[model samples]
Target: MQGLDEQPVQAHNIDGFVFLYSEAQQKRYLSSRKNLLGHERVLEQAMESGYRTLLPLQFGLVIHDWESVREQLTVPKENDLKQLFAKLEGYREVSVKVLWDQSSELEQLMQENAALQAERDRLEGKNLSMDQIVKIGQAIERAIAARKQAIIGAIQETLNPLAIEVIENDPLGEDMIYNTAYLIPWDTEPHFSEQVEALDRQFDSRLRIRYNHLTAPFNFAQLS
Candidate 1:
């Protein structure tokens, strides 16, 4: 064994003897470490030059022409190489497993989004049906007709003073009419119920008398 300080400067076989360098030399090598492209260039150049470089251990100096110097550079048996290849395959499997898990999570999220979109579309369709403008128009027409008939019947029976002209019989429907205002006096309002009751007894089956007294422009007898 040679002392650390007195070790031979030059190595006999680059592969057989491990190169030992000072701390300063190690730092210099670290600083000179090549990038990916530089390393690829170095490998290509070395292959063309018929030289192989190898680092024995982490702290060992780089050895050029390792095959010429070291017997260990001799190719191993097929089975030995296969076992090393299997270890690398195991590392690849672990990486694939991690990626597959992430892919599964993404697939689940995509399915959930699709379901939400479908539900939203269904709700939108239902809302459109409920708020349909044609349906609203039909309902308004029916309500107005029913209210108009009620007003007409109430006027005929409750204030039977004179000619109740149907001057503007603009019926929105069979039951509803527009511009069917009455002509009745303010004083006859006290006897309004007696007149309405008399009409009710006579035409109760034929007409409906839903009366709400309203202010009129003229007397009941004058309009008649």
Candidate 2:
């Protein structure tokens, strides 16, 4: 029979071999001084109980014939396995610790979200108030009316003839008018300008004439 430390023996070619623990046999060879002769005796007894040699590699001891090994090897009962229970307890403790940390973080986020929602609700409430909304709408209407009046006055003042036909007026403002246009005779423009200048002096602040180029009513020849 070849021993385990006898130069890495192949199990299929060997008639029989004794498996030894590398822990017990510190040496790599069967003939070395560190070879455990006492453990070899124990392994021989185990092999007689129907245990068969299996291939050995890098990992820990692997022997076939489990039933024979079970009968020969002494192991603790399930109730007396303290090390297994301790490992499971440690895993449970770590899992609980992780879950607790996650729960605290979730709660803090929920609280912050709730505060932001409350602030949003307050702003929405202010925006939806009937009085506030009505006031804003009224202000906008007034501004639009003022702008329209200004545009009409500008158009009326810029056109020649000083006779602006008023189409619309603002009910709220006295001088504000809308859609006014001017009409002037094409030949009388120079004379009309002298009269307009005199009128402008008379009512400089009250009435202002603005002139714009209009298409001549009819083209007139120069009277030389």
Candidate 3:
């Protein structure tokens, strides 16, 4: 709880976990909080309080009045909310974003893919037909897809032992392949994060791995 107040975090104890909100003086502070930093701190506080499960709210969740809070926490949604809390009791969300280093990946592909090399050689000759060019382009694309798939598969395999569920997010860019999240137990987080470090090394400077353990379980807890 050290420095808990120093940061722009002001919260309230709700039904199952602490809920963070912006106070009158904290309005500007909350507005400026970017990248969900304060929101993440709320999740950390929940975890510290022995509430392994959490119903993570987005940042900038401001409670305008106490009545709304009471109504939301009471009878109507109470039972269902408790069920969610129960389900998430032992789980914590962890995120992993695997970014492809295009230059490095392309270099590796060009070096190891004999077919692409052959295609390059064929394309080097003068008077190549349009169909030949298309075929060579298709071959290069397929080779890149195959290699990317293998990398993702290896990452999933590395994380399978530690995660309860895997959730894939939309890729960030042409060079970025996977933006995934996992629902792992509170106890296994250390091991899972360590595995990510191993993956970063195994990719050998070709893939950049970023992980956020304090992320909300939104990826896993999305409602139907």
Candidate 4:
């Protein structure tokens, strides 16, 4: 929550939401990661702090000097940062990861994927053409893609009503369907988490729903 260089790394309070970052090292050593205490910890500290609102900087962001921090945070981008901060002042951020069990999902999919199975059976004979095989492969890929979209879509539909904003993050692994961050009002966090807990129970059989961490509105502010 506090230094990029040898100095202390406390995040600056800019209108309750914007936090300016200074320069960091070119290489990331274990020592440096330890110095920053890892991104999650830093973010957690900021959110838990007494600040009315705090904007998180992206991982490994740095400027050449303190001058850059002051300049970029204050006068840069025609003060769009300030405007964004003002817009985000009363909200906070939370991480929610939705992971499906590939084996279980795959099993369910296969039972429902008769066309894909038919294509596979069609390819078994040595008489198959290369173009046919390629087409079958593409078909399989399309089926999987469709299933993933369906699963993530249902999840999004379940939560979208509660979120002020939601940003999709890159999936962490093959089983990850959605790695999302939500912008929620500070007072509404309990209801948000309650909904997540219900989702966890509902998806217990096939998906792992993790309500990860609270942090500054990094995703909402487009910090990463």
Task: Name the candidate that leads on lDDT.
Answer: 3
Candidate 3 residue lDDT tens string, 87-112:
78888888888887777777778889
lDDT of 1 at 61: 40
Candidate 2 — what's its lDDT?
Answer: 0.35
Q: Model 1, stretches more than 4 Å misplaced?
A: 1-168, 176-179, 215-224
Error of 3 at 98 (Å): 0.7
Residues forming the 10-long window of minimal summed lDDT in candidate 3? 1-10
Residues forming the 10-long window of minimal summed lDDT in candidate 2:
90-99
101-165, model 1: which lDDT tens digit per residue? 22333334346557543544455536456455465445444544454455455554444343233
Candidate 2 differs from the real structure by a C-alpha RMSD in angstroms, to one decimal, of: 45.6
lDDT of 4: 0.70
How would you encode candidate 4's per-residue C-alpha lDDT over 97-210 as one tens digit per residue? 888777776567668888777667766866878898788778777777898887677778877778888888899988888899888787888888888888778766777887
Runs in model 4 deviating more than 4 A are: 1-39, 58-68, 101-104, 114-127
State residue 201's C-alpha deviation in candidate 4, in Å.
Answer: 2.8
- Among these predictions, the greatest TM-score belongs to 3
User: How do the predictions measure up, each by TM-score?
Assistant: 0.21, 0.23, 0.81, 0.73
lDDT (Cα, 0-100) at 161 in candidate 4? 79
The runs of at least 3 residues in candidate 2 whose Cα sits more than 4 Å from the true structure, single-residue gaps closed, are: 1-127, 164-178, 188-224
